[model samples]
Target: MLNAIDAIRIFSGDFQETKTFFVEAVGFEIGFEDEGVCVFDLAGTKLILEEVDLSEPEAAGMVGRFTGVSFATDDIKSTYKELSAKGVHFEGKPETEEWGGAMAHFKDPAGNVFTLVQYPPQN
Candidate 1:
């Protein structure tokens, strides 16, 4: 059987800038680095960045970054405040989403969107 996906990687225009944003701003810890790759640890998840020598992004069929990543929290408001205080740029304030969750959105420096969700309260 195959295990779940544990790491995600994408090429960046600037590895150091991307690394700084991920480390200082997004709360990921530096895991390791090599000639072409930098790894970051976000709690249990890992993100990798690779260096690409080629340019011409539009013609190269390169995506700016990874697809949106979501995390669930027990208290959406608290998480919002905490991350906000630490310098996360939120796209909008949290609200009742049609999906029946308290939700907030953020976009990482790489133009990748992320969502924080708290499932509908249960009695």
Candidate 2:
């Protein structure tokens, strides 16, 4: 069985801008970088941004796609405020979800969506 996700690949039309956004705005440390790819350490998992040709059939549909990368935080509200202050634009304030957790959405420079979530405390 698969134990864990080794990395997540996100496609971007503007590689430099997307890489900069993740490093500066999102506070992810750079793990590796090259001509068309940049890797970031996302708490342990690797977040890989790859440059792609949007005109190509296979990659055309992936541009601006929602990544579904959720980052868990102990305090959603404070995390939202801190990220917003760093020039990160969020969809809105954190809201309660049907799963009883608080979550907020945001996008990277290339419009790849991600979320910040805080689960309810277990008794």
Candidate 3:
């Protein structure tokens, strides 16, 4: 039975640039790093960046896509503004979803798209 997520992986040929993006621009702390793998500590779970050879077509296809990763924040607008000020490129301004949440998308140096989301208040 599935329980919890321990880590998520993102493949990239440009590891150094991607790592810098997560550490500096995204403000993620490096939990560990080796020759070809870098792990960022996202609270308890980890976001791992694995270096891949772009020469291989399948591996190259992994980079630059929607990651389906959404980071939760109390205020989407402020978070988006802060990230944008740091030179992070966002798809557009934050928009309200049908569920009453707010969301904005941003791309990494490797072109991997991630989301910043603010959930509706609890009842």
Candidate 4:
């Protein structure tokens, strides 16, 4: 049986920029970068970004895709503030989420949506 998701891939038009956004803005650790690919490690999973050339005539007329990645945090507000001070622009301020957590959502340079969440404190 599968124990967990080990990696998730995200397509990117500019892999380096997307890597930087995930590493610096989203606070992920870049584990590898080679050729046209980049990878970052979340707590227990890996986020992989692969480059795709869309400007080529053969690649034209194709829709660009973005991935949504969610992250967990212990303090959403503090994480949001730290990232904001480091020049990360959030989609909105952290709010009480429907899943019983505080959440802050934002997008990367490659248009990938990501969320940072803080679970409600245990009783």
Off by over 4 Å in 4: 56-66
Q: Report the lDDT tens digits of candidate 2 across residue range 1-123.
A: 988999999999989988888888878888899999998887669988999987799887786878898999999999999999988989999999898899999988888889999999898
Q: lDDT, candidate 4, residue 20?
A: 80
Give per-model TM-scores.
0.73, 0.92, 0.96, 0.83
Tens-digit per-residue lDDT, 1-123, candidate 3: 977898999988899988998888889999899999999989878999999999999998999999999999998988998999888999999999999999999999888999999999999
lDDT of 1 by residue, 1-123 (tens): 967778876666666776787777766777999986898876777777776654675623444543566778989998899888877888888898887788898766555567888998786
Winner by TM-score: 3
* Candidate 3 weakest ten by summed lDDT: 17-26
- Computed on alpha carbons, the lDDT of every model, listed in order, comes to 0.74, 0.89, 0.92, 0.76
Off by over 4 Å in 3: none
What C-alpha lDDT does candidate 1 achieve relative to the native structure? 0.74
**Worst ten-residue run, lDDT, model 1?**
57-66
What does candidate 3 score on TM? 0.96
Winner on TM-score (3 vs 4): 3
Clashes of each: 0, 0, 0, 0
